[model samples]
Target: MTDAGVIDDYVTGLRRVLRGPRGPKIDLVAEARDSLLDAAEALEHGGLDRAGAERAAVEGFGSIGEVAPDYQETLSVPAGRRPAALLFVSVPLTTLLWSLIWRVFPTGPAAHAAWPGWFVPVARGLDILQMLVGVIGGVALLVLGRGLRRIRRPGTG
Candidate 1:
């Protein structure tokens, strides 16, 4: 099919998806149209064949809904925050629960509880640190994703 024809088909598919009421429906048709137009312009100047240009356009634009499921799972706009939040909540909670259990359990009546009791605090602190690191890493990922999106935006060099 012609490049224009292929682009139209892609747009139609995206529109059909968006028209549905399930999940995070987005205006993928508009996004594909813009991407195709940009790619078509480049191909026109670069002397690429219709098929080649269309393929490039579609591939470069990527699948609109490909990242949607991840986003939903993470409860993140771009899909990185969910894991971060999960880690942030889980680590501390798990550490505290484990610490309490460990501290309460006795290895032996003669065993000194004071020295061993410190281990629980140390483990809990490590858990908190792990959570902090995860949060920072997640934020960095989210920020990088945003930067990439900006770079891909129309009119950007």
Candidate 2:
């Protein structure tokens, strides 16, 4: 195959392996294309025929399978301490706010007497829903924190 054909095949395989935005993928492909062409031109200048130069360029660059994973890792978001810290602070604050609300508006005769008959049930239901949402958020925060820790660990991906 021609140099262009080889580059196209390699880039197609690369695009399939890479994840995320189109812009980054296109940029990476363009970079690879430039490098491959440069390598091929260098080899040709060194007295190799066109076909031989192209082949040598592709071989030296390595196959898509061998290089894609490394590129993907580079593209991945790095785990940071900030997100875990934010979650840790927000989760407890949320729980505290909900607890205060629950305490301030005790579900008792005084509450029912002060508000309409429907108000108590509605308020209780809303409180329960908010609690459930808070719990889910806490769990999500925990999971995110754990994942961040794993990503931050040495010699891990």
Candidate 3:
């Protein structure tokens, strides 16, 4: 059987103060619980009763106030990276790919003379749409990052 209250209380309090993405928070909380339980078991093996060992284990864990900033820093890293994927890498790389393709086989006077009537307008429309979507998506991500920052607890990001 598990030693209940002391460990439960410590984990609950730790969960309360931590602010981050859901997946990381769950992993960190579960990790903390496992470590506490293992330490408690080791203490009990040294002749302390389960309750006494659990209480002591909790005490050994620093106060939530003292540890939360560290946890917040861990959470912030992934939060910061989410935008860089699209904004820094995918967007620029995709734009460069398209530019190179057009440069190698550009639609100039000779190419346009051979092209069907429908191709020009269709290609032009798609170009406009691509630019519009890129601008809209970039703005949305920036706004979303700002919104996430606003909602997060101070110093949590």
In angstroms, give how far residue 116 of model 2 lies from its true place. Answer: 8.8
TM-score of each: 0.34, 0.53, 0.59
Residue pairs whose backbone atoms clash in candidate 2: none
lDDT of prediction 2 = 0.67
Residue 62, model 2: Cα distance from true site in angstroms: 0.8
lDDT, ranked from best to worst: 3, 2, 1
Assess the local accuracy of residue 146 in candidate 2 as a C-alpha lDDT between 0 and 100. Answer: 61
Q: Among these predicted structures, which one has the highest TM-score?
A: 3
Q: CA RMSD for every model?
A: 11.2, 6.9, 5.5
For residues 103-153, could you state the per-residue lDDT of candidate 2 as single tens digits? Answer: 766677677566556655766765776677577666656645564344432
- Ordered from best to worst TM-score, the candidate numbers read 3, 2, 1
Model 3 worst lDDT window (10 residues): 148-157
Name the lDDT value of residue 85 in candidate 3: 62
lDDT tens digits, residues 92-116, model 3?
A: 7667766865665578789767766
Q: Candidate 2 — which residues are off by over 4 angstroms?
A: 1-3, 78-157
- What is the per-residue lDDT of model 1 for residues 1-157, given as tens digits with 9 covering 90 to 100? 2448777777666555332223333433455587797897698679988777877777777664663333233322434445557666877776787668667654565654544657667767777776786777766676546643542322122
Better of 1 and 3 by TM-score: 3
lDDT of each: 0.59, 0.67, 0.74
* Angstrom error at residue 69, model 2: 0.9
